[model samples]
Target: MTARADHLVGVLGGMGPAATADFYARLIQHTPASRDQEHLRVVIWADPTVPDRVSAVLEGTDGPYPAMLAGARRLCELGVTVAAMPCNTAHVFLPRLVADTGLPFVDMIEETVGALTRAGTAPRAVGLLGTRGIVHSRLYQDRLRAAGIRPVEPGPEVQAEVDAAIRAVKRGELATAGDHAVAAVRRLAGGTVDAVVLACTELPVALRDSDRAGLPLLVDPTEQLAVAVVTTCLGAEAHRAG
Candidate 1:
């Protein structure tokens, strides 16, 4: 497939720098490109200065909309055809971002739920592991319910562990992060959940395959978002060709 010069992917990231970097890597890894010329154009605005999303959602303090909007606007100015955010917690403000910027963005949360529904014999219940903000906002829960799948969330203790994993990743402590993430997954697996969604992008980076042994199936939202981005960009090219 030939790359389209007209299409550019904008990543509004740096909710935590590591997760954003991971998402970009996944995007490149998943793209159907044989040579450098076959790759899609991408612009990334990674500003770690964005206020804390967790504090905003959990405590009602620190609004990140302005910083996020600024990033989105910058991407728009760069001529991005479509945008995506890697952070799950930041999605709480996605509606306002899209409305304010009038820029099309691939919804990571929606894409994740859609992926689950499309899977043959969708799991009756799925575990959610992410920042306290996303879990409290019920972003995944509401969408999963809409898709006729139950969303199982970690308890306070497990959620704390999940938070620790995120922090570890941000600190560049992969080993510690993996330990925390695996512990949370193991705890969630004891429940009736058929699969666990790594709702936080950092969780996927932290949790390795060796750590996943005997744990329930894990879903990575970053992976879903990458696939959605590739499809959105390449699909648009195909549509234009037709």
Candidate 2:
């Protein structure tokens, strides 16, 4: 069997530094193992200066992709088998990122889809809550449909709350301080459907243990994605034996 240290989980995070840290914390706590060696190898490049993914995409990156690429390359250099970004918006550039970095990346979209499917939660209409770029670009919508699930875009007014909460986090607000975000999500989830996917990493921690909207709520994709990463990075025999 390969030594656990021989593998590393590359995190292209720091879209919100705190959320990135939160994802790591959750992974460490949730990893199923008796020995520390059973824990997955991990590396992270928390580049807070990666620019606003929403603006960069909707408006324009208007600059070099060097910084983003450099971050991923650094992880690959560290010898990580799989790298994943916690930021949903940054996913906009992932195809090129994967091409340029030559690093196997766990897709947040695909991971989310698979998680929903495993729970047998497919085909249930889900409320969309994410950056304007994600919503306007219909990023989640396209992928959700591919998974045979229906997605509902939050009305413009509710989206305002989502935007405010995201912006507040960017401004370095306490992850759980955004009361309005919870209120916004609760409003959107009411009488909606089966569940709400936090979609944004910033949101999972930001939303925390707040009251649910009488509808089931899905927490951080980052946390779940981390679980997926650890599972995938574990050698085949280890996984089978696990």
Candidate 3:
């Protein structure tokens, strides 16, 4: 019998260093294996130096594309079977990265929406909490609309606070960041939205476990991406082992 090949998953991270670490943690948490060898192999190229994605997309400035491409290329060179990136804002330039690297990337945005559908929790409207660039880019808006869910965004005043929360996470201020995130969630919840999406990687860091219990359920793109990464890679490993 021809044996299936073991698959390796590559992560292009470090849009924000803290977010990258959190993504790895979530990946570990979601894996079904109990032993070290039973886990999926992951190669992480964490380049916190990747220029800010928000500024690049909005201000017409040089963004993290080149750095991200370099990381993707390195993973390709290492023979990773599939690639995933943790940052939502970085996804704005994903097409460029895919064209440059020729690697199959697991789409975090698509996966998140799919997750909601599979969970049977398709809400009429989902509140979005992320960087201004993601909102202005309309990345999530169009997708959510297609999924039969309206995308509700924070008002300018609340978005400013959301931005502050993201920045605080980057600065390693978890407590203050959590407060900001909770405030943003409260505002979005007030609109009678069913759920909130922590569309930005940094936003997830701002939310504590206890805080998540109180707030409306958050649809986490990072966690969604992690789940996809684990499922795909481990499924491949199982086929190979068999």
Candidate 4:
């Protein structure tokens, strides 16, 4: 499956550097490529210095929009036709970013919800595990409701665990982060939800196979976004080839 020469995928990342790297790895893993040449061209603009998206969304702090828009412009200058932001919280600014750059973006939130609705036995109620910004902004909640799926959120205490897990991942504490994230998942699973969405990019990094065992079905939005990006860059037929 040869990659399309006219297509280049852009990654607007670095909201947290590890999540960006994880997303790129997933992009490679999902690409239907047995050889290097079959892989799509990708340009990543990762700037960790961008202001905090959670603060912008939750606390009325300075926005990360300027920095994000700058990254999109850079991808555009580099001839990238499509873009994706791995950080779930960063997507709060997605609409404006697309409008300003005229660069189409793969919406992680939409892809995540679409995956659930398309599942063999679509989940009637799904638990959401994301940052406070994504939760507060109703990013996943709104989409899940529109898709006719009930959205379940963790209580404040459980959300604190999620927040701690995200922070732990940023600080390079995978084991500790996994503990916190798994604890949160266990709490959410105790509720009536059938599956859980690891809505935050970092949550996927924090959760391990052992952690997921015996837990409710977990959806990784980063993986969903990666598959979508591969399809977008390679076309549906080529994407299915590998």
Scored by lDDT, the top model is: 1
TM-score of each: 0.94, 0.88, 0.92, 0.95
Alpha-carbon lDDT, every model: 0.89, 0.75, 0.84, 0.88
Ten contiguous residues with the weakest lDDT in model 4: 233-242
Q: For candidate 1, what's the RMSD? A: 3.4
lDDT of 1: 0.89
Question: How far out, in Å, is residue 132 in model 2?
Answer: 0.8
Return the clash pairs for model 1, or none: none
Ranked by TM-score, the better of candidates 2 and 4 is: 4
Root-mean-square deviation (CA) per prediction: 3.4, 2.9, 3.3, 2.0
Candidate 4 residue lDDT tens string, 1-242: 44476688999989799999999988888777669987778899999999989989998654788888889999999988878999999888889898899988999999989989998888899999999899999989999999999999989988999999999999999999999999999999999999999989999889853456788889999989998888877775555421
> Residue 187's C-alpha lDDT in candidate 1?
91
lDDT of 2 by residue, 185-221 (tens): 7778775657677777777766765565454666457
Q: What is the lDDT ranking, best to worst?
A: 1, 4, 3, 2
Q: Give per-residue CA lDDT, model 3, range 83-155, as digits (tens).
A: 8999998888888788877898999999998877777668998999999888888989999999898999889
Q: Residue-wise lDDT of candidate 1 within 92-150, one digit each (tens)?
A: 99998899998889999999999999999899999999999999999999999999999
Clashes of each: 0, 0, 0, 0
Q: Please report how far candidate 2 places residue 115 from its true position, in Å.
A: 1.3
**Candidate closer to the true structure by lDDT (higher is better), 1 or 3:** 1
